[model samples]
Target: MNNIEFKHLILTAKYFTKYEPIIDTKTDDIYAYEALSKFEIDNNLISTEDIFRHLHHNNKLFFELEKRNKQLQFESFTENKKLFLNFDADIFVSCEQQSYWELFLNNKKDDIVVEITENGSDDETSANIMRNFSSWLNNKNIETALDDFGQDGSMFSFYMMNGSKYIKIDKSFLRQIELNYNYMHYLKGILTTIRLNGQKSIIEGIETQRDYDLVKELGCDYMQGYFFEELMIIK
Candidate 1:
């Protein structure tokens, strides 16, 4: 299934998309639900990563697939909860101007946060594209989060024009924080800088009390991963 015959597979308006809650550690309530893509075929769940990687060589396929994912997510939206959608910087930059925003503006703009991955290439063109797009999102009362914001030296520079209300501390740094003072210290430094810049920090991959206590002591605004609850999927 890795090499999906995506061209042959009909891409519907609202395909198989899943929503996972990002819990607020302070309130112990869900702050928002992130839209994820998954394909279920013959009692098997196929991850979006399979499609994401396979279609990189075909720009048109990638954009259509991602657009379909976004449509499904918004179609399933409940007014009470904010929706967080992870977007591909490549497809985001290539799409028609304000295309998605036009679709979203008629909805509750404040209830949406568009998350762009930390792993995307930060070339001048990509930066320029996201910089403009992010500014537009901010003006529309939409927030942005730099997801997976560690394990890369370029992240700080990446956030200047890119940073919004949140910075998701990558799960890599969350691993073994108590056992490794090195990890703890680095985590502290990252959160400190992020706070100083007026962005809330989300400690990702907190699956144990140790992870919880440590971030709590350090004053992380949010936490996500198995420690709170395994991500819930509609299917």
Candidate 2:
């Protein structure tokens, strides 16, 4: 409920938070678990979207909830699978958030991918800051992945950013590619370009056998969606 205290909600999230597995299509191995926030309240499962929608009016509470999510995930993370955490590019500019993130990197120097989600904009300032922070994280063995590539204008702006080691192709681009010849070729070109750049590609939304085979042809480094849904390895 909107009336619930932020602290209490955070406590509630710890018991309900889950991680969804993202697989390596080439190896059939568990590459990482993308942390997803959830809370069971009153016999109903509350998702991260639901919590944020209700807390939209409260900025302080929103920030606190995010911090708690990271803390809980970090404390429980194992070494076997990489921990994938998503945040906007601007979040790293915060002194508090940066300190917290750095502490996590210090403890777990491997298998952590900080996914930069769709931020408000991709101006020089935010883009440059993220690039620099990504470099810092690289030196610490904490990799950065550009999430939702080409989903929107702001996200598309990040498509050419050379700092990321991993790039997640937006699902929208692949939704109808298998059915359209032109779309298929276009996607093939994109994947080829990514490979040429020496960055691994994670093609999202591979829901069918055709999709999987298609990406395999394109040399997709990773794949996720309903096709691999049954392969949930996060437990």
TM-score of every prediction relative to native: 0.81, 0.80
Q: Which stretches of candidate 2 lie over 4 Å from their true place?
A: 1-7, 53-59, 120-141, 158-160, 233-235
Q: Which residue pairs overlap in candidate 1's backbone?
A: none
- Compare the candidates by lDDT and give the number of the best one: 2
Compared with the true structure, what per-residue lDDT tens digits does model 2 show for residues 88-178?
A: 4444566786787688667765667888764455677666766667666767677778887767575354433466788888777777664
Candidate 1 wrong stretches, greater than 4 Å: 1-5, 10-15, 41-43, 95-97, 118-128, 152-162, 176-179, 230-235
In candidate 1, how many Å is residue 16 off? 4.0
- Every candidate's lDDT: 0.69, 0.70
Score candidate 1 by lDDT: 0.69
List clash counts for every candidate, in order.
Answer: 0, 0
Determine which window of 10 residues in candidate 2 has minimal summed lDDT. Answer: 152-161
